[model samples]
Target chain A: MEQSYLIDLKQVVKRFPMGKGSFTALKGLDLQFEAGEFAGLIGPSGSGKTTLLNIIGTLDLPSEGGGTVLGHPIEHLKASEAALLRKERIGFIFQSYNLLQVHTVFENVEFPLLLLGMPSEERRKKVMEALDWVGLADRHRSRPSQLSGGECQRVAIARAMVKQPSLVLADEPTANLDAANSHHVLKTMQQLNEAFQTTFLFATHDEKVISYLKRKIYLMDGQLVKDERV
Target chain B: MKLAWLLAWRNLMGAGLRTFLNVLVLSFAFVMILWMEGVMVGWDQQSKEDMRAWSIGAGQYWHPAYDAYDVLSLTDAHAVIPKETVRSGLVPVLATQASLFPQGRMMPVRLNGIPSQQSLLKLPTAALDTTMDAIPALMGTSMASKVHLNRGDRVLVQWRDRNGTFDAMEIELVDVFQTTVPAVDAGQVWIDLSVLQELMMLPNEATWLTMGEATVDSERMAPFVWKPFSELTRDIDAMIETKSSGQAVFYVVLLLLAMLAIFDTQVLSIFRRQKEIGTYVALGYTRREVVWLFTVEGSMHAVLAALLAAVYGIPLLWWQSVVGFTIPMDTEGFGMAIAPTLYPVYSLGLVVTTFVLVLITTGLVSYWPSRRIAKMNPTDALRGKIQ
Candidate 1:
């Protein structure tokens, strides 16, 4: 059976104002992704890849047009409601592995659950399971600074997947890693994706990242130039 | 809420140097504020105690004339004095000036004459008994020394009669009184009331009466026409008011400086963590949540500082209160024998107020920055720039 589309972006637009003029970061783009689909948004620098990811992540609203995510109308939701939706259903992984530097690996994974007001026992169970999935269960007590690049990315992945959200947005998650570390992180993420059946969306210019995705989205400037299946 | 608190705690600990400097500055400010408040309250309480000792005698009292110079005539006393007033508990005393001669050396001295021994008993104990009869006069230590009189020596008390006739009487000095306040005891004599009446030639009248206990109920006392010692200490009251105004002005300036320091540090902390705050917002925390989180952090800092200040402050204040801070022995004219000491009295209200002030200022200063976090696109935060 074909799963329904979880994210649908229709003619999304974003603009930036420079001195005496304007810069269009996203010039009327349309995109859609089905549930459980592993997709990659491949674009060069300044191609509005992060902007589009932000819009889908509900971190930024479209200046023009409307869309929906996970059956909720994005345009109609208030800032608080959008935040609620993000907390409950959306998970984010950043390029720099934005785990709170002061928190240990386990604590970073437990953060979203804490925000969700989950009880300690349940949060521990979920966090441990997520850490086990990332193969970082032994390094649970290590802080971000103590971890290597691959370990940090794995911790970030654990943080993203611990909440068991329906959608996981990864923005250049392997940009900071070496070739070997990058391959390891990608393998760990693919394994988690298969095991949890959580949809993965990657915004990256890395050919390595694009090759791993089942669907590829190509962007030029602020517009989508191509969409293809592997 | 717990997550926010945890984040705040760890952030405070993560940057050791910044946290130390911030807490040091805050603790110093806290100490200054606590000390100032303590001094003000201590001074007020001391003044009240002094007043009670001198006039009201710890509680309240009623007197004959509102103005000290408006003598309590026999007729006026009957009209103003309450009908069921506790007479036995009241002490009638005469205060006047008299000329004295010791071996041909003459000087004027203030004389306080009480009706009975019980009245003198209520006065605080100096080295000598405050009570004296015709044969046993209590002379101030300074007066006794100047007059070259031993315990058995006699002095001539001379004064002008109501008719302008000059008269002299000799009395034996039985005891010499030494007080903590040397100035008060130096030029005064306490004698029995009958001897005073004979000397002043007002055999049937008393100058003012002191109540050993409160005769006027606080509620009823305000509306009732009553006299107080304020009339006698009008000049002193003016001087005290001037001193109070100066202290208040000084404290206001100090508090303003302290507030500015608190404001600056909190603002700097928020600005430095702007990106992190934006990330928190992007992680589904609202603007209000951000504000509350920082406010709670500031409050926690204040509470910790307050606890430490209390530990150090209480002992210092108590020691100062008990032993007193000493001034140079050679300092003259001020006549303050027991030197001024600041005793900070800690109250829950003060702690609460300090905490609230810190929290509110932190919330206000961090408000705009935290709200900016909510307004930023998460991608910008992730990129470490809002623009």
Candidate 2:
């Protein structure tokens, strides 16, 4: 069978109001993401890489055209429904490593499962397993602040993957990390993708992240200029 | 809501010092509000009791013209004792305006006549039962202290009889008693009923009959107007209520200050933790759920405060109620039945009311700033951007 698309963006357009006139961030871009595909949207500044990521993550709505994720129409989706979509299906990893600083590593990882209303014993097992993948199983009790930058990023990864979501959207996951830590995080994500067949998408200009992508889509000036296999 | 509460509790605890300070201030507010209100309520209760025990005995039957509040009403307030006066529970007492001299200073006084053996009042009149060489008299400690008089002291007493003629005599002060009822203690003197009857030439006539523990039908004969205990003490009750209402303002102010701290902290937390808020949304919480979490977190401070206040307030209040609150100032100066020290009474209702009030107040304040989240854009919030 032909590869199925988990994400299908068609003629998507996004504009933001600036001063008097509006600024177009994404113009009529079409993109498809298949299950278990490791893909990246690569571009320089102002190329709408993050915007497209946000739109696909269901954090933003298209000004004109829209898309679908897991067969749910992105346009006209109520805020609550969109939130439910993000909650049940989409996982996000930010460049800033947006881990809840106050929570311990385990608590951070267990957050999603808690939201899913999972039982305590099950949550514990899943959290520990996710931590194990990030190689932070022994550091589950440590707060985000107490961990190193690389460790914090790994905790963020654990938190994202803890619920075993269908899709993970990473925005420059390695933007703040060194070469060794970046490779470690990418390799872990790679293992999770292969092992669970979870769809992985990245919005990044980082060469290290770009190198790991099975497919690279290049954008400039708010339009896709190229799309190709790595 | 369970999920919200759990997450809220975790967040508040993780906040550490910020949470502790808010809880501390709010707790102190709880203790202060409850303690102050309990004491005032206790005072109101005590005053009513003191009035009942010292003066209004369960109720009274006043001569139609008799008004204890009006000095002029006393001039002709006396009437023949109502037939109800013969009842076992009725204690008929005569009162007439008189002038007394102590240390050569003349002062007006209510010279009341009571049966020395009567058990109806707590007047300590047994002192008058003594057969002294001079006239046996009883004056409250406040009157005695004010006039520089003491027990066994001979002083001049003068009064008008039914003939409207002035009479004078030197009578010995037999006893000076202390009483909590201001009306009973201030500038009042007590003497034998028979002697007063003879002196006033109005046999079996009285201004009022103080009802004892038993009830009497004063309406049977209708010589005097029957005033129930509550009606007799109406003014005092109103005064206490008015005072309590005024005191409520201070309590609100205290709570507001405490909640102000909480409100300020909530606003600051939302402002500083925009990214965390976004992360929560990204994790799956609805905006409304986040608002509720902050509300519970803020209100939980009150719960913590109440527990903390209980740790100290219970002991302090208990000790006070037992020992009684002493007035630091002279009791004679208060002009009313104010006990020197007031024992605070904390009823279960009062405690529960204060708890609920604080929780509601804190919850509302927490929700106020958390509303900013409802208007927040998660995409921008994810990057720690305002708006």
Maximum-DockQ candidate: 2
lDDT of each: 0.67, 0.86
What TM-scores result for chain A when each predicted structure is judged separately against the true chain A? Answer: 0.96, 0.97
Candidate 2 residue A43 Cα shift, in angstroms, is: 0.8
Question: CA lDDT of A30 in candidate 1?
Answer: 82
* Candidate 2 global CA lDDT score: 0.86
RMSD of each: 5.1, 2.0
Q: Which clashing pairs does model 1 show?
A: none
lDDT of 2 by residue, B56-96 (tens): 89888888898787877877888887666776458778899
Each model's DockQ? 0.54, 0.76
Clashes found in each candidate (C-alpha, N, C closer than 3 A):
0, 6
Query: What are the per-residue Cα lDDT tens digits for candidate 1 across B92-162?
Result: 55556567787887887766665544432434323234444543467655567767887878788876655
- Local error of candidate 2 at A119, Å? 1.9
**Residue A197 CA error for candidate 2 (Å)?**
1.4
